[model samples]
Target: MAKEIKKVVLAYSGGLDTSIIIPWLKENYNNCEVIAVSGDVGQGTELDGLEEKAIKTGASKLYIEDLKQEYIENYIWPCLKADAKYEDYLLGTSHARPCIAKRLVEIAKAEGADAICHGCTGKGNDQVRFELAIKAFAPDMKIIAPWREWSIKSRDEEIDYAEAHNIPLKINRETNYSKDKNIWHLSHEGLDLENPANEPQYNKPGFLELGVSPEQAPDEPTYVTIHFEKGIPTAVDGEELGAVELVTKLNKLGGANGIGLLDIVENRLVGMKSRGVYETPAGTILYKAHNVLETITLDKETFHYMQSQIAPKMADLTYNGQWFTPLREAIGAFVDKVNENVTGDVKLKLYKGNVINAGVTSPYTLYDEEIATFDEDEVYDQKDSAGFINLFGLPIKVQAKLKAKNSAE
Candidate 1:
């Protein structure tokens, strides 16, 4: 016996899985009123015709909330400042899920819905990310994951169901690749990408979305100067812009230069490894520029500690759907402290999948040329290092002396 669910709030994207979910919910849940929620985290033109489609597909109402500012400022900034990348893979889809799910929970509460649903498959990381956020915001809300409960086992079966229900789908078996897009990045999984042995058809038409491949890049390099204020990008090429505008500007420049294309086999929270291709134009540019700026602004200890300690953990937390946790918040506080003086401009040359540092300048730079010079400089006494080395190696000297003494005796 199924529990009676009068109304359900769905985290809807007009994608294939979500498009079919509306009708399936109605069939299984005794024709419950489905309120579709789509968080517009910079999906741009993808939001067009979503309301009409939702309505035609049997949704009661569709709420398209603009969450781009929150997504960039609240989620992407902290990760960027902390330099968090999971196994050299930029966490594009990982963090976006929480931002979307948070909005879903809010809409679910406001609409007085009985349960919340999502289109995440059973094997993916998104299910964990979405549900954890729901628990954090609305703990008692019942989560109805259709993939886990429904009989639809594969994409083939899903397409069959869609056809039987007279649902018009834009995708077929040949062109279908599971994808997620936001302003920050676009991720592609499924299809040929599922096999690690298969190289991505980067040159194929419609294969790459955000940027081109290294081979397709131009001969002339493109140089970009990014200005950061306390670790947040504020300008590009001397023009001060808002957060959204800054990222958008960088995306075009970086994409044109064939930047921010990544393919990696990453460990998921579900205890399995998945291969995916990620195109994160602006994010890659911002991360590289921020790293260059930090090299001058931050001290040796703080820089090393952040890169070694905070970065990997922050990556794990974000990858594991622990964004709203106390530890992540505390880590954010520490990151904020370290980045207080990380204000500068970083110039980079983008040429065929490379981000070469052209220049780095900072108001609070610790890189003093005089002190670091190898030539005779009054700023640093080279002879003074002898005493420091003798003291630093005293334990080794003592152990050798004791060994020699014991052998002689």
Candidate 2:
């Protein structure tokens, strides 16, 4: 019921599902040239052999774009500024998908590709993410999802297909857990994680490489100072660095101190529950530091309102893969306005996975030392509270007086 696609650009990651997808698309789509595009959004050195892997597995060509800078400056920073955390998560994996999908659309248009394909499963949020971004950018582009169309039901079937087609896969029987990794965080799912009652052995050291185990962390405390200007992190300790460098430094320092580790069962947009372990040391540090700075910089009412209303919506939008939509952009505009004076410095002590706030200060701070002093102060009058309390409790006093008079009568 769809138009015939000549050449397809597939968002390939060289995983089990994507490996089989390359050969599968070629076989089914009349042997179309499947151009593979992998977005290098801080996957580290894992991009080394990705191009070769794609080509060998029947891709006509491969495009690996370095999106680390864009990812940090555009996507991650905006979410961080808004304090966008989905169900208390920093939205590590979800935030990266839109940027990657956008690039895929760009590559498709440049190559005159008839269709865009992905390996996302039918039930997952990524299928919605990749497709929505594609639709947002290039509405007319034909979308192909192999998992929705294919007869393959299990990972074993995918392995068999890859073997038959000579497609190299990175998965094995031992490392059965499926993971999505980026600079922000790493997500673990599948296997035992599907069952909520199963005790996750995240404590096993070397089980994952993102950060150290809490038990394995050093007993001695590590101190770090974060400097922020308008809610954007500008420096670490006293050294000024760019966005990439600062996050990398914090990741190393925080990871060493075991400062980030999370286990949560979250509700997916697709109406299913998923349990995942995320390690985001740098993100954890950044969130805490930003929150501390806001305490000094933001006014009580506006800050509390934004915290209660705007923050959760931003988190929900990011988690639901609505990054490229107008609502998110509008929210970002509001967030930028609110963060205009959020400049400050926060000193923290990290010990055995605990990040304790030592102190926070800012030039734009609303904390008036003169008014808050218990000792003699000139700013606030002590007698003003009597009149203020009388007016404040007028309704209560009137109600009680009326009730007493009626009872006496």
Candidate 3:
């Protein structure tokens, strides 16, 4: 026996699962008014006519909040600065969840709703990300997870529910390849992807929005220059752009050259391994370019130290849904300090899916052409290496000498 919920703000996406949740919530909660809150984070056409669809499916009202800029600047930029890639994933979908869930909480408070709901499946990591974000933001707010509570077990059941309730869905959209998209990246799962051994068909219908198959890419090389200021990308190809636009511009260029396609079997936070193919054209370019700049700007010790923590910190923060936590904030401060002189231009050559670094330059570059030149220069004395090597290898020499003395005795 659960307490009665008068109203709930559903984090709706106008997708199959969310479309059904509207009617399902009403039925379970004695016909409660479900207010749909759709956070638009560069989902493109997915937001088209969302309000009408929500209202027709039994939602009392719909709130379409444009969170694209906030999503890019607040969420995406922080993760990018931290180089936060979960298990080598750019975390496009994982990072966006917290922003969405936080917005859901804001909508819940604004609407004075009794509970907040999301359409995450019980078997997936998103449920944890979404719920934990909700908990962090609104500790007292009731969370209604339909997948965990309701009897609707599969996509078939959800589609059936949608039909019975006369909820309009995109009939042409193929359900074979389940996908999630945002400005940063697009993730593909389900269908043939469920089996790890099955080779992904680039020719699969409805696939390849951000990239052509590597085989289909142009044979010619494409070069693009990315400009950075204090580690954050400010412009691409001389055009100053905002966070979303910058990513969008780079995604187009990277995809044209078959740049950012990754197939990996990753450890999900829910204690399971899932295989997914991710296309992160813009993210890939940014990552490679940023690292190139940091090479010249960051000291060897600091760079290596931060490099060691990049993966683990990314996994813990992204997986645990602590995108806005103090720990992440502290890490960001350190990363920012490391990027102080990361200001520079990186020219990368994209050829048949490979992003090869062409050239890099920075005002703070520690590389001295005169000192590093192959030709002779008056910069240093070569004989100094004798004393330096002796000092450097002193401990090893002493240990070896002791071993020889002991053997003789």
Index of the highest-lDDT prediction: 1
Candidate 2 per-residue lDDT, tens place, 65-161, comes to: 9888898889998988888888878898888999999999999999999999998998889998888999999999999998989899988788888
Candidate 1 matches the true fold with a TM-score of 0.97
lDDT, candidate 3, 9-78, per-residue tens: 9999998889899989888898888999998887888889999999888999999988888988888777
Candidate 3: Cα lDDT at 2: 38
Once fitted onto the true fold, the runs of candidate 2 whose alpha carbons sit more than 4 angstroms away are 1-3, 398-409
**For every model shown, what is its TM-score relative to the native structure?**
0.97, 0.96, 0.95
The numbered model that scores best in TM-score is: 1
For model 3, give the RMSD to the true fold: 1.7
Instruction: Please write out the lDDT profile of model 1 over residues 1-409, one tens digit for every residue.
Output: 2457999999999888998999999989999999999999988888899999999999999999998889999999999999999998778888898999998988888899999999999899899999999999999999999999899999989999888888878789898898889999998889999999999999998888788898999999999899999999898899999888888888888888889999999898999999989999899989999999999998889999999999999999999999989999999999999999999899999999899999999989999998988788887877899999999999999999999999999
Q: Tell me how candidate 2 scores on lDDT.
A: 0.88
Which of 1 and 2 is ahead in TM-score?
Answer: 1
The whole-model lDDT of each prediction reads 0.92, 0.88, 0.85
